[model samples]
Target: MQTQSSFKTTETGTLFLVPTPIGNLDDMTYRAIDTLKSVALIAAEDTRNTQKLLNHFEIETKQISFHEHNTQQRIETLIEKLEAGDDIAQVSDAGMPSISDPGHELVKACIEAGISVVPLPGANAGITALIASGITPQPFTFYGFLPRKGKELTEAVTTLAQKPEALIFYEAPHRLKKTLQALLSTFGVDRKVTLGRELTKKFEEFIRGDLEEVLAWATETELRGEFVMIVAGNPAPDATVSAVATESLSLPEQVEAQIQQGASPNVAIKTVAKANGLKKQVVYNAYHELTE
Candidate 1:
């Protein structure tokens, strides 16, 4: 009663890129299971993780380890099978592949070899968290798990300093506090932030607030679950060219006057920095500005 494309062995015989659920069993799609069962091979980031999923659905398709460590040596063998018209399905341990995962090169090789790749719609913790974050809900950038060291993390955040899009970042539970702290220091404590944990799982939660508030909340409670962080979009500095509270104004009265003229103290400092050809902090030091 199923269509001819029910399994991976459609008339095309292309490789299907499947996305497994991040943490829930019920999230599995029907077409994904049928396709996994039909494919001649199931290339996975972790065979053991995929094993549990396969066993749950009672799928007997053969599993192969195709993670970052050994993919270079295995691509040739995989290509041989594809050339023989044996369709396969590739999956990551969780969520989508090639997005902070190791499937990009493999997928690229398949494409270059004249083999087709069909991506199946499924779960991605980042996008899922973005919608639930209730941030600006506009264009956002996704930066998967950040570099471990503080210096490298700084470089990463600074690289996007001028980007006006909301940013999404994934972080481990242990590194969550440090990551937030680093973001706060680099982006300023007042930047709005949303943190998503245990997404799509029973303990799912989203904490939305300014960076300082959220950072304090994180410290007061025990942090757990996979984290998806959405940071407020960087404001376009060009718009606040007349920010007067920032540069030469050292008194609260002067800063407050600029605020009444529709320029946020932060934006004003940034604007004055450009006008005076100096650093923003250099300008803000004279303004004595802090929202608290």
Candidate 2:
């Protein structure tokens, strides 16, 4: 447990976590600009991208590349600078760092090394989209970007399916359709969902409706830009629905049942794997043995 009284004493150089605009340069906060200008060094995910922002504001601070690929190597250098009383500001390509982006490792390292980490709030795609999504925003789970494939993805979707709060997920355009299909399978086709793309920019658009409709729209439309998916939480099951619908069957048995009901084996595996919090491979091996 550590208590951070930021700015109370400048004995050590602070590590500032500054948020840049997701899009629409004007969304960049005054405080973020000031920090970027004031810091000794700006460690950015992409120096070229950040340089553009810095130039726009006439912030002459120098930047070094710090991204997922070079995080381990760069972290040591950043920490050394912090230890040497050189204040540093860390920014991602856009929005907040460590939110489905780099900087988490550096923050962790700073905490362990007893360095001060100060975060300046600015633009965030998830929260920005959520407020406008017309979905219940409070008590929402921000589950960043879901795993790409296999049991991890299935289990992640399944976990979100059981929660009563709104769910937020980030997805690239290429994978958006597949993720929506997976959600349709787990959360049912009628579950409410909203898609926010190119947020805060001129091309920003929001698609809101049932999962099936949204999935169809996404499939037919020309996909582009990053997406923030705001999905309504699980509705309360009707009391009339049989408890046996859930409790009577074990996990492997459940997979077999879904397969019998015309679900593909892969789909059933994903759904069941998520429901059981087991790996897809584990469920697959068990299901095959059970059938054989």
Candidate 3:
């Protein structure tokens, strides 16, 4: 067991996980600014973007490029510096680091090395959107981003559909419509959803309604900026009934049953495969053999 005392004085340097503003600059907190100014170095996801932020705050602290592409290469170097007692702050392009961005690996290395990791929470797009979404707030699951591929997305949504808590997801504008369609198909038409766009910015807006209604609106609207989607959970009684009905079925039987309940063959196969921890092709072959 490892314990961390964030403020305790240690021979090794502390690793600060600082959250940058998601959109509006005014959202940046005082402690985040103070930490950025106080740290020995800043490990930034995008040096160029981070430089712009530094310029705005007049923070002249040096930055080292630490992003997904260079994470493995940089962790060792950062650890060495931390061991040498050089305090470092890590930041993403926007929002909290390691949410849908980088910084997780370095944090892990620091923890393993017994270096303190102090996180100063400033802004998070997911929580900001959730509180105002008019959805049930407690007992929520934050799924940063869903898979983009068709089969994988369907499988993911199918698994998430069984959860009895609000679900949060981050999506890019270009893929919003497709994701909403996938959610609509998996979670059903009447499931409640809220889409928050340009959060905390001057043009911030939210669209709240059932999945079917939001899907229609997304189809007609021109999507811009990143989005935070809050999806209401499945009804507990229905989810419980469905789980009970499927728990005893064989793989082929499960796929057939899903198909009988209005799911397409491909979706049924993927859902059954995911639920059983089996490959989709295996479920597909099994179901086909049963039919043959």
> Candidate 3: lDDT of 241?
27
Candidate 2: stretches off by over 4 Å:
237-292
Off by over 4 Å in 1: 1-12, 238-292
Cα error, residue 198 of model 2, in Å, equals: 0.6
Tell me the deviation in Å of residue 266 in model 3.
5.4
Candidate ranking under TM-score, highest first, comes to 3, 2, 1
Candidate 3 lDDT, tens digit per residue, 111-215? Answer: 888899998888999999999999998899999899966656766788888898999999999998888877775576778999999999999999999988998
TM-score of model 1 vs. true structure: 0.78
For candidate 3, the per-residue lDDT at 47 reads: 95
Relative to the true structure, candidate 3 reaches a TM of 0.85
Among all candidates shown, the one with the greatest lDDT = 3
By lDDT, the better pick of 1 and 2 is: 2
TM-score of each: 0.78, 0.84, 0.85
lDDT (C-alpha, whole model) for all candidates: 0.76, 0.84, 0.86
Candidate 2, 20-92: lDDT as tens digits: 9999999988899899889999999999999999999999998999998999999999999999999999999
The window of 10 residues in a row where model 3 has the poorest summed lDDT is 237-246
Q: Rank the models by lDDT, top first.
A: 3, 2, 1
